[model samples]
Target: QMQGALEQHLARLNELLASRGDYVQTLKFTQQLAGSIVLQLQGLPAWRGVSADLTELSGQVAYVEYYRWLAYLLFFILVLTVCLLACLGLAKHSRCLLLLMLCCGLLMLVLSWASMAVDTAAAVGTSDFCVAPDKFIMNQTDDEISAEVVHYYLYCDQSLSSPFQQALTVFQRSLTTMQIQMQGLIQYALPLFPTAEKDLLGVQQLLNSSETGLHQLTALLDCRGLHKDYLDGLIGICYDGVEGLLYLGLFSLLAA
Candidate 1:
């Protein structure tokens, strides 16, 4: 009986020794895992504030900005036209043409100013699209680049806008609408071969495209006055191209 008890005690001692070894090994591994996790968490960066300043920037956001500036230019042109009219008004020159020119210029100027006021909404709205890295956590590509733009052109345009970039979105929606109108004109002409309707439609399209292109170009340059000659030359070309389309469509319809 004594020998049997001794054997049982030895068996229990061996089990305890094996369990203690395993516990020591497991504890060591757990400590390493916990320490690694702590280190990794420590390496992570904290949040930084995102920001934007309108006056300090000019890029994609500048497109809308330039539109605003153009109104100011229209104002300048209006003033020049006004001065010309006033000089002629005093000179007793062909008062009719002067008056007409003056009226047109003044009207255009007023419209431009009004449009400028409205476009401010566009500029303010773009602020939403502005991605401040801290506030917005996006893949680097999406935050800094517009994948749609051929160049992934750093949409350097400061969109630093409101919650949803509402104004910016609405402004873009308008551009998209203009695009749709342009598309509709083309589609309308497709079924009709050289008809008057088709001719008119094509002419209108050319004009629309020309105008949109001109607006885009002027907007692209942020109205810095650096590309006046380029814009002027392009405008003349686009105008002639549109007029030419009108004439061509007219002649084609006449022949048909």
Candidate 2:
């Protein structure tokens, strides 16, 4: 009876070992699928070129913006000083102060016109680019990215399905199936085959890591994250930067 029972346990272990080939095949496919999805994401313009450029551009813009504020403040103080000199000259009938005021007024006029001209030109150029930014971006990319991909990110319509949704779904299903198999072996076969405990726990740990990767991949594949970055760059350049220029232009006009 003991020999018969030993044979029965060996047969069950053999069946489980046979099924492992299928599990290994599924794991191999899942790894390939993950690699393909990552490559596809990296190939897109949003990830490859646009994101890097925007990050660098943001840093540059911040540096320039700091100096711009300083220049504006100095100009404002100069204008105020000239106005005070003019007031004192008129009250005291002082010829020397009046002469100084006249010279400073002429200099202010020239600077004001130059600043206004630059601001107008910049505002116009920015407006032109904003009018049909999609075309401009497409042209710049030189046909490297498809229009469909660009539109998907630019619009970010909820109705549109994610590009990697199918692959992610398959990955999730395969992973879950693998986990279930591993758990079954840990529960049922571990008592019969004590040596397999270490291998089973190791596979469970690997599957857990894969699950974490899947979550990260899903977040990266989502359009909203990239779209938010795009919008932020536009707001910084178009709205904030241009608005500051307009304020500077107004100050120039007042100073003039």
Candidate 3:
């Protein structure tokens, strides 16, 4: 749950930050509005640094996954070879093959113990995380996302209010106000300063786009989405990850 929630939040945060480009363009357009009415644009948080970090993390995950698959494949082959050698030795009554089979069986036994140890550690760690996933995620993402936002998603209870509601309200009001102002300017001011018509229309368009973005942002910030992701992640980790490890441990025991 913690891993899933963190990943979902990071992905949303990245998307929110990426929208800064449109905000920047809006700021530029707002500068032109300064001639008629003063409009102060709030600065967006820096996203490039966070984006770079996420990109690096993605690369590392891919690398790790590739190696994990390779390791599983190699282990499977090793077990199959051992089984084949045992069969060959028994059928042929060959001393050399039997000796080799003995050596492989000893190796398999050591490896099974090592694998069991690893599986135990992994299961323990996962159980620990499952106990207080929210706290773990909060600690991990303290530097990246706000505690209020994190809490809102971690415990998506009906009574809990959205952390972004106020911000979204303000954003909606601001967009409506801007759109009204732009419409008035286009209607009245265009007749007086015909040359400003192009800029006025552009600003109106930008305001519309911003309003759409605000709606999208509100949806993304909703707790249901992130909470669902968290639940799914928990299911995967608990049901699939741990179960698979147990199966592997069983196989190891059988091989030994």
Candidate 4:
């Protein structure tokens, strides 16, 4: 009977050791999975950073656009004032009005030449931008974004597929793969751990929001619309202003 009891005691001890081993392995697996999920979740912050940068750029461009429009408006008023003065000088046959008209005409002519000179210089500067806007923009950016990525969006051709699109595709694919892994870990690999499930669900939400932001960033980075606006500003301030002022000066001379 003592031998039978000793045999039972050994059996119980073996079972206990086996159970402990299984519990330790399970804990190790859980720790590893939790660490991986946390790492994957951290990637979402990059999306936030890109979004903020793009938005700030858009705002700055718009502010400059407002100033461009104001300059055009002031130029228009100046031209109108010169024309009205010339007309009054002719109608009233007044020497003072005529002198004023002559002075205004000279002023306009000088301004026209100055505008042309300034615009020419600006065009020379802008030519560099037209050639490689990405390089110009890179000078303004921080190290958070790589130069290669900026060039990918700026220099990419519309006739071909965009690198930004490819990046988004790959980004989404990676997120999907990681989410699948996390889901598997939570469901099959760690069902008994409700805390892991909560963490994984939070990660999934972050990834989902980041995916939405990525789509918006793709649209924002197109650069075509921004380029078009820049071209319009150049034409308005440089070409149109010069031509209008030249015509006004000629008309004033004819009146004299």
In the range 1-102, model 3's lDDT, one tens digit per residue, is: 322332343344334334445433443443344322212223222336655876898799789869867976877788899899999999999999999999
State the lDDT of candidate 1 residue by residue for 1-256, as single tens digits. Answer: 3223323433343343344554334324433433343344344322222123223333655686477458556655665676777777768877786777668766755665555544444334333333242223234334443333212122323343222233334434444554454355345433442333443343345445644654564355342242354346445434553454344334323322
Best by lDDT: 2
What TM-score, to 2 decimals, does candidate 4 have? Answer: 0.50
After the best TM-score superposition of candidate 1, give how far the Cα of residue 177 lies from its true spot, in angstroms.
62
Deviation from native of the Cα of residue 22 in model 4, angstroms = 5.7
Instruction: Count residue pairs with overlapping backbones in model 4.
Output: 0
221: Cα error in model 1, Å: 36
Model 3 residue pairs with clashes: none
Point out where model 4 deviates above 4 Å: 1-31, 41-60, 138-142, 151-256
Over 108-200, each residue of candidate 4 has an lDDT whose tens digit, in order, gives 777666655555555555555556554566776546666655554455546756445555565566656645654554465345544344445
Specify the poorest-scoring 10-residue window by lDDT in model 2: 1-10
Return the candidate ranking by lDDT, descending.
Answer: 2, 3, 4, 1
Local distance difference test, each candidate: 0.43, 0.72, 0.67, 0.57
List runs of model 3 lying over 4 Å from the truth: 1-62
After TM-score superposition, what is the CA distance of residue 81 in candidate 4 from its true location, in Å? 2.4
Off by over 4 Å in 2: 1-49, 141-146, 228-244
